[model samples]
Target: MNEYLTSLDRPIEAVRYAGLTVKLLSTGDGTEVIHHTLQEGSRWSMQPQEGWTASESIFITSGSLKVTVDEETKVLSTGDVVSASPIKQGLVFLALEETEFIYISSQPVFQFFSEIVRKNQELAIEVALKDGYTAEHCKRIMQMSMLIGERMELSPGDMCTLNYASYLHDVGKIMIPKSILLKEGPLSEEEWEEMKRHCTYGKELLEATDSPYMRASGTIVEQHHERFDGKGYPNGLQRDEISPLAYIVSVVDAFDAMTTDRPYRKAMSVENAIEELNENAGTMFHPEVVKIFIDLIPEWSKMKQGV
Candidate 1:
């Protein structure tokens, strides 16, 4: 094997989160060096797993960073170095501006992070297969959510959260009984209550990963059912109390659900779905999101028609 590798060499692994890219630069002798590029306004947080005690060191190579270790926070520019104490409570790194840094830590720690991303990907596939509509519905929701997110000019971090949350929002449905999920008639009141538990299940599912991105995504999963008028379930959180990403997911998910065939009903026409959304605007859905989504329907239809 070659003793040295160049930038052209393929990364051992790479992952993107919250507008940041993490690349495994090198690993050997129980240590790994990871390169991180954080887009301006991006932030990453790490909380040590129980019994974790290895320290990690970071060196900034470009741009500016705001780093918090325990109770202390510091701003660092190019060429600055900071070392985190042995794995303890919250350690946060934020890019005040676009920043590049190298982090050195035990290879096992890096491996753990890599494994979590891989597991999440695998679980997503499993969740998508639990029902026929889930895969297609999630895909459409992701696309529509991105369109609305672009229209809203969301920040990069927000877009990242929105992207992941849209796909994983219904993941908890995997746990629902197949009979209830595929029921062709109206659900019993008891079945409906059981169905509503999916949001909480989804949140718990994502929270197990202990990833900041997953945590953010979990928040959306939990609140996506909330209404603008504060009548929705799980938590009845009112307007603006819900995460903006959750609002986007909620709007897009509803649209996708209306336009897609369900076991209980055929798909609604786009015009009818739009009417339904309009009727519920500001009560069940965010008014601005509803407006933007309604405005985009024409373009979506045009594209579908190959215009």
Candidate 2:
């Protein structure tokens, strides 16, 4: 590993295994993410070892591959996401169509999972915002969620989890087609159903990557769409049935959506968004989270006003 022209000037360069090239995205920042590209017919045979952990999450951006994790072997197609475990699992990247993926992890399956996961998260946030939400939305939700978590007196580590979880709350929306996403009218029932699938799809997409944060994030993503009144789709879980993270996200997500201009609706003034949230509290959102969210509205308003 050399530091010249490497991504971010990190002290590590590329880890090569057969026809796959794994580039370290960062190191020690705890946001481990990686960019992995595999050539056709590449195979990584794992030799059972100790003291190191590596989990391979393959997001087939293009082409196909046959990945065998332990005793299970699965064929991954473009857009398919899968993960390798800490246990001895050999992977054969047979590119059925010349595959590419942004591989992410907390500890490199071989040498750098931490950097991979962190960098991948940063990139994932960028990819997710490709829908036009902007990375600023993630920053706001992260700040707001941490503030809410503090009010509830959550543990530091738990609050950190909430921070990243909040940043990724809308990650599932990445899979939504941009046409429907940017449509200037109320979503058709079919479009609505497609949107609803993001909750489940996002979780399924991350289930294999083996990042604990991503694992925990799966639940939040799955339930962020739920309503306080059990009216949300995919799962109509209501009130306390939803996780606390989801409760926090519901408030933040709604607030952002209303406050930000979308193709279908003009942006409501912050005051109006807050008033709507307040009016619908305990019906559309958790009342407790609403209080905290409402309090932050002032700061958010100032930020939006560029004050």
Task: Indicate the residue-level lDDT of 47 in model 2.
Answer: 26
Please give, for residues 1-307, the per-residue lDDT of candidate 2 as tens digits.
2334544644556654324567766555343566667665433222222443655465667777774444466787879976656534323344555567766654644342334334435544554433345556665666667667767865444554565467666666667777775566578998888978878876765554644445556777788878889998678999889887788877887788777765445778877887899899888888988987777677666655645
TM-score of each: 0.60, 0.60
Q: Can you write out model 1's per-residue Cα lDDT over 1-307, one digit (the tens) per residue?
A: 1236765456456775436678877877767788888887555555544444666788889999876444467898999887755655544566899999988876345564566545545445554433334444565576677678779977555665776688778777766777777666678999999999989988887777634556667889988899999999889998989887888889887877777664446878999999999999999999999999998887656533535
Q: Where does model 1 exceed 4 Å of error?
A: 1-132, 302-307
Give each model's whole-structure lDDT. Answer: 0.72, 0.63
Lowest summed lDDT window (length 10), candidate 1:
127-136
Clashing pairs in 1: none
What TM value does model 1 have? Answer: 0.60
